[model samples]
Target: MSVEPLQRSAVAKDEQWNLQHIYATAKQWEDDYRRAGSLIDQVAGYKDRIDSASALLAFLEQEEELGFLYEKLFVYASLKLDEDTRVTEHQARVDRARSLGVKISSATSFFRPYLLSLDKQTLDGYIAQEQGLEYFKKELYDQFKYKPHVLSKDKEEVLSQLGEVISAPKTIFGMINNADIQFGEVTNEQGEKVALTRGMYMRILEGRDRERRREAFKAYYKPYVGLKNTIASTLAASVKNNVLFSRMRGYDSPLHRSLFADDVPVSLYDNLLQTTREHIAPLHRYMAYRKQKLNVDELRLYDLSVPLVDDCEVSIPYEQAYETMLAGLAPLGGEYLDILRKAKTAGWIDVREKQGKRSGAYCWGPYGTHPYVLLNYNDTLDSMFTLAHEMGHALHSYLSDANQPRISAQYKIFVAEVASTVNETLLIRHLLKETTDEPFRRYLLNHFIDTIKGTFFSQVMFAEFEKLVHERAMNGEALTADAFSEIYEALFTAYNGELVALDPEVKYGWSRIPHFYNAFYVYKYATGIASAVSIAGRILEGDEETTKAYMTFLKSGGSEPPLELLRGVGVDLLKPEPIRDLLSLFDDLVRQLEEL
Candidate 1:
């Protein structure tokens, strides 16, 4: 008899997230949903009337209340759906919530145009007259920064109405990736051919068996390769749509528009790409080291993932992983640890793999509730590091929510990866320091080196790929599947150096990245790691001032721009030093591994 993967229903109650924290029952969800619907009406009622200071304040307050209700409703529904995606009832709830979300967007689209309509003098006079505007003053004034980009009210509403249609490419790609794509089969331990899964694919990549790694790599890419043209069309449409909006909004380019919200300059993006390429030698040396250590004739892309240190695996249970993570992160101090500890038992984590559960992991929750993490914990060392990474995001959310008001509590996407990387950095450093076993020490170093390779180097490569594709599209070139593959292969060659041999499947890598649909978002992953290296290093060195600043940085949230927040935490990413230092550190780790 075939033993099926455990379904979510059979999972232990304690291993699940208590989504009831947001709603007691389906009835409560319906009540909130109806309330949000009425609130949409109430918010729309104040539309053109938000001319006076008092009227604006009242409108803002009402919108905030509606936002709070809407988030609770949407988040609960979405989380339930993710628990077991096959459930139609939960899917319907999410659809209802999303429908409500779209309405909310349509109703509020007028506010930005209206706010931008006022002259500085008029807005200042209004703020001066109303004490109630104090809470919203910063956010209010911040709208002026987008004055150049804000469309007229009619245009704004039209754009808002077209939001779903405009976002169809991303939605289509997501469905193709998550719901429809299929991988080929691989020979399992039982000598039977089993369909390859994402989890199994990653594990196989890290396995000692070269044949298995090669087989799994081909299997994983089989579906992507087959549907390459379809995926390419989706990505092209997404890019062109971004360029269209950028042109419509009077921005210089799509890249500029992405950075405009965070007040980031074009130079910052360009600098990261150029600087990494300048310092690419260390990565080349490391790639050569991988080839030498693996004793493979040619280091194929598939060969790059298996552990350099073999036969050094450790089985860490979930409970032990949590404890070790707490220990690794203890440098953040008792207060941070206290909250991390509480999250383990407080229904803030969904920590198991089950049939129909969402694949991969993320930290998500609406404001007014603790952050929830969805993890498929498989008792591996990587799983332990994942626990550290996600909880870092969780506490960042928790601290920010507790400290800032609803308007500013949500951090920008640019800084979202920093706190998580800091946790990963610290955890690896702690593990490195504690292990005296030469092989395990080398393994830790290799693991950390590979993390940097994936997170920092590869991301910069992807970012540059984005810039090139978007630039080509902006210049009126066709973004074909072959074009994407050529660009990606060249980048893969440049970034990974000439040491690794390319397989036919390597160029098609771009077809699998979900982030490409999001447009100019992956560059932050590189910047985030640079900042985290500095902050984690200081914290590990007992720099109390930096720790305090980082805590404050977490709490400040989107109240300030991401660059300024990193500056406060003692990392100026605009300068060449942070990236250079991170590269040098990567070099040092690789050299240490070579010595070991």
Candidate 2:
């Protein structure tokens, strides 16, 4: 069946996210937009006077208010824009929101430097003396922690003014990927010309028909291949920007700067890479098994994603996916499950794909409002898992917002993926236990194996690639399209060995990865699954104390550092044990698959 893309209006109201919850109408959003500008000005007035405890408390409260309002404005415009990228009006709203964000940043640029100028004792006294200042103690301490990197007020203002300019690389990449580039159409096994998209590409790759998979693979990369140089240039600019900013901030490298922000030690990243390399054999074994199971002449790059157990058919609609997710997450207790139910019925999710919508799934919203998830759900088992995954993020946000203050509600990227993957780990465990049929059980087992491969192993590979590219860029190596492809190809070869054939077009795969733009962000996905696997296992074993501790960790949000947060939940990323244990689990799963 050829899939016809729907327009925004064609999507059912229940299927769509209610952005109106943020603002009832466009005029309301506009009103808040203008009001936010005034709030920024109001916040700027207390800049020089924040040295006193009372003034500092007032500043903190006003600042939080301003941030809350700004989030509502920004998320509304962004959610509207993502609903359909082609709409000029929505695009304008996004631009307006972004501009206002820059203005707010520039206006409040003095906060950091001014706060740092005060003595530590004075700041400590303020936190101890003022009731309101207690809420932002962590926020204040983080400023002092980065004191060496804090620039002069004038320089800080200048940097803040350039926020929009610095964001150009990511903006350009989004424009080209979501708006300009096109993948054209491909004929599927149904003998119909179906439109190929980023979302559809994954579905096609999983199809049993090799020819269609091959065709879709080739067509999908066609546009990216043609624009490789342009995309590469944009990516290069992003790296350079990261390097420049890191250098300006007195950091040795971009990796240090990024990790520093989250309070993650460099050793943690190194440990993950080293441990994953040592455990690469199981991944290679899985690849060989995949080839044998498919009975293919050669397992090419495109064949990697095709289903291993072809006879077991599992199709879950959206409503059923919700029910499945709720049941899967019941281990978290009734409170967590109730929140999940509310998220589904409320306007917390935009659940369908339409023309010009952003690809993939994500959870986004400000502190004041509920977290809204954007998913291009395709009704596949994978899509159902995606629903489970994103709901994890939403629930994490929901719980954090309810428990923590506005300043601490937004979790850091380092620990962000844990909640989502924990949901997935539990879901897969539930499915495996619930099913009695042999083939379906095998399918669930294979899914678990594949999840580890994609989430843990593949992410490590990408992290290695990202680390290499950033090092080269920092060392003044020019990053061109060919250079990027060569680096990725070398890493692919080292990781896969002779188990899978590396098609030439697979080298261009680096150009299409959106995470590359975010600079050293992929490694956390590996660490996240590692922690989640351990955490989920404990919950499934009926460890009530562990479950309570995990809930507390989720509610803590950014109140503490990510490392401490994970430690609170009994999964320490600083040591190599979690990674080793996860690898052991992967080995066992691969062995089980072999037996089956």
Candidate 3:
């Protein structure tokens, strides 16, 4: 079938997401769901056998089969959920997966607690006893890293059962953000009114008219401010969840627990925030230049996203954008490039905007299937950037799946953004160099500078806010909406001191950022972007060693901790060099824009 026909077939029902790709029909999905249900019963059979090394290994092999099936079922339901929030049937299917998740989790809870319960000698002996299970030794050894806090099986099962409830705060916040709350309309300076949707907010914020950007900022925040208390409570609840989990798991702090969940060190996160704080002067200086160029007397919060060069625009259709991105990423060589081309031809990308579709973009899929990307294409430079970002993730999954076992194919959240941001960095740098048109070059250069600012500096500022909120809550302080606003407002002043006017309403910025609900999540964006900038430079310089190491990082999957994974790829995030390099690049771009 032609691309047009396939596209129509995929989205024929106007469903939130296209699930037909997974099972071809709802009946097939039901059949798979029932198959998953049957597999749940078989898990109980393995419970008793888990104590014996030989029996446990056999059970693990059986469990992997179940896991593979469950992944398909789960991914199908999740993609459906992302496509449209209004699909009740898909919601029920998602709920089914969530509810069954507890069962599958409970069935496997004994594996870790039991392994840790065994003495190191016995565990090592078990590894020595069976060659078949030797490959899993690292997997077990990684679990034992949490040995100090490993709970008893019964307690672990209880935690597993409560997992859904434990994840409620994030779910509630997502529902509110994606399905419940709505921002009112804002009129641009030209008197053209636009609905202040989450997707359009950025477009308006980047408008040339200073007053329109300000109005958009206020109009966007208006609903969030009114609903501030509720959003604050939701965020507070999430923090409390992290705190409780950390305390219960014997971690030192919420941040430690969050980072430790994926084996990330606290030092890396701390270093990122501290380095960004020390370097805020550069960011502020850039912002000051932007204010002068935009000719705003007192640069307000709304003035932040506006481009200094107003008349320039970079617009490319989807196909041209793909080719441009492909050329930029050619350094990865034939194998990696071939995988991306397959992804493009395989209907792996859902690339157009439609009604009721979720805001933002993500690359998602389970094991045994190709990764899928969902994007709202707007034919702007930013839209092209989003495509690059999501494709980075899709390609990472593609490489990991092809290279690693299903058991370890999924990459952790910590290293997840590295791949995506690396693509964006490469794509932006290529655009800057390839396009000689002065106006477009300036626009691309300014856009690159803005990305570094937004993704690296601004996220670090937000991460600081995350750190403060968690620490404050730990110290017997309540995170009321007002209190949050106060803390975040002061942070804004510190972060953008001389650059822009930190409006009081900007205090509620914390309420608008969804990452805060995920606890210590936003920092990764900063660190990831920094690492990407560093890595992209190496690849562009045709450093074969760096390019090979970076591809190895992509293929490493969840086999190693995020820090070690990146370290293996030659970027030591503990030192502040990567971030400094990013800021320096931003400085260069700033000069280039000035020269233009």
Candidate 4:
């Protein structure tokens, strides 16, 4: 049945996340906003005395406290705006919060440059003398590591002042994609006119009706086709921004600059792309099986998302999904489960889709508060897994916040996906063990295969595309809509092989992906799932020591470098073994599905 999306007011209270946990009222939020602004000014007053140990310690403590309050205010306003983008007041609050954040950045711009002015030995002596400075030892050392990239105080201030303007491309892209682009209606299997949307378009693609799927795919890309030139310009500007920052910072490339932040080796990114390309046969085989199972004359891009076994239905309600996630994550022990239970009832999740709500799911929150998850959930096996995946992030945040100080509580994006993917892996493993039905078991196996294809294969494709575009821009090549489509088409052909028929519209698919605006971000998803596969395999096999190591890694948070943290957990991404093992797992699952 085709139905209109519900209004935000119509959603049940429990189904929505409680933002009052952050601030009970808008007036309270306004008060904190004022307080944060005052603190930013006070912190800036110590600019001349930043070299002193006592002054530095007091400034760091004040900045940390201000950061916590500012984050709470910013998250609440931004989240409320996302809940219903049509609200003007919410939009104003979001703007105010963002503007305040830029001001805060400008106010604190002196800290890094001033700290870099001091020699490492002097900074080390300060850390040893001042007990309070001990808390920010890693942070101070990190600034020293970036000494080469740190600009003069005046230049740094200018750059920091441009933060809001520098972020304009992504802001424009979000408005156009989320609020402006209109996908027209499509006739469904029931012969009713269904309004097509980004979310609805995905559901339509997963339908059994072939014509409807094709219709939705074409309809969804129609606006994108019309706005291709504009989107291309926006994306080009975004890429140019990345190149600009890389040059300004004296890095070899934008990729180098991005990886340098997290201490990830460039070789690791290359290894994933190379390793996945070598193992393309399994992906081709899976495509072949999908074509045969669907019995399509030609496997178009729309056909890729549909289920291989049509009768394998697994619909888990939210309550049941929560219970299943708890059981699946039992290997992490009782204390972890207790935290999950509290998060479940503590209004940490907003669990329904409605009109003008932002599409997709994410876990976000400030350092001092419990992590909040935003989900546009519809009951499906995929949604159940999403619950587990996001909870993985939530628990990770919970543990990190509880263990680390405010300064180091937030983990880097490189290792952030590991926790989330680990939960998904355990949930799938538990499902496979408990299911007795042969067809359903095969379906479970297929789900795992699809996850690899989507998370590992697809993200690597995006990573490669991002790398190519940025490199092209860096090398003085012109980037246009046609140029982007051509690059994307070639990569799609290489990855999909000759088995699947390519659609011309799929070439323009690059414009629709929001992640492109955030350069060098998608590759982490690939590395994350690979790490999870190795870690989950060990836990499922009763490796108690590995399990203990994994738990400790979760608690360590941003206290250590991302690669070093992963090494502590026994998953060394620097080696090719994890990627190879993940490919082997995919091959084994495909064979199992074939046998069933």
Clashing pairs in 2: none
Clashes of 1: 0
lDDT digits (tens) for residues 265-383 of candidate 3: 78888888877777667677777787778776788888877777654555677888888889989987888788877777676887766555666788888777778898877677778
Q: lDDT tens digits, residues 1-596, model 2?
A: 11466888988887888987888888898888888888888888986676578988887788777788888888888888898888999999889988988988878877877777777887888888988777788788987899888787789879978988999999999899889988978996678997898778898888888888889888888899999999999999999999999999999789999899888888899999998888788888888899998899988888999879864556678898889888888999988988888787788888887899988899998787789999988778888888999999988998999998778887888889999999999999999889788898898888898889888888999999888889999989999999999998988877876877877788988898888888888898899999999999899999998899999988998888889999999998988889988999898888988998
* TM-scores, each model vs. reference: 0.89, 0.84, 0.85, 0.86
- Candidate 1 per-residue C-alpha lDDT over 441-543 given as tens digits, one digit per residue, 9 for 90 to 100: 8878988898899989989999999999999999999999999999999999999998888899999999999999888899988999999998999899999
Report the lDDT tens digits of candidate 4 across residue range 1-596. Answer: 11356887887777788888888898999999989989998998988777678888999999988888889988999889888899999999999999998998988877777888888889888888899887888888887899888787789879978988899889999999999989878996689987797778888777898988988988888899999999999999999999999999899899999889889878988888888898888888888888888998888899998878664556677888889899999987888899888887788988878898887899998877788999877767878888998999998998899899877888998888899999999989898989898888987997798889998899999999999999999999999999899999988978887877877688998999999998898999899999999999988999999899888988988998988898988888888889999999999899989888
Could you tell me which residue pairs clash in candidate 1?
none
Report lDDT (CA) for all predictions. 0.91, 0.87, 0.79, 0.88
Q: Which segments of model 3 are wrong by more than 4 Å?
A: 1-35, 76-103, 106-116, 151-200, 222-241, 311-315, 350-361, 374-380, 477-483
| TM-score of model 4 (CA atoms) | 0.86
Q: Which ten residues in a row have the lowest lDDT in candidate 4?
A: 1-10
Clash numbers, per candidate: 0, 0, 2, 0
Most TM-score-accurate candidate: 1
Question: What's model 3's overall lDDT?
Answer: 0.79
Query: Candidate 3, which ten residues in sequence have the lowest lDDT sum?
Result: 1-10
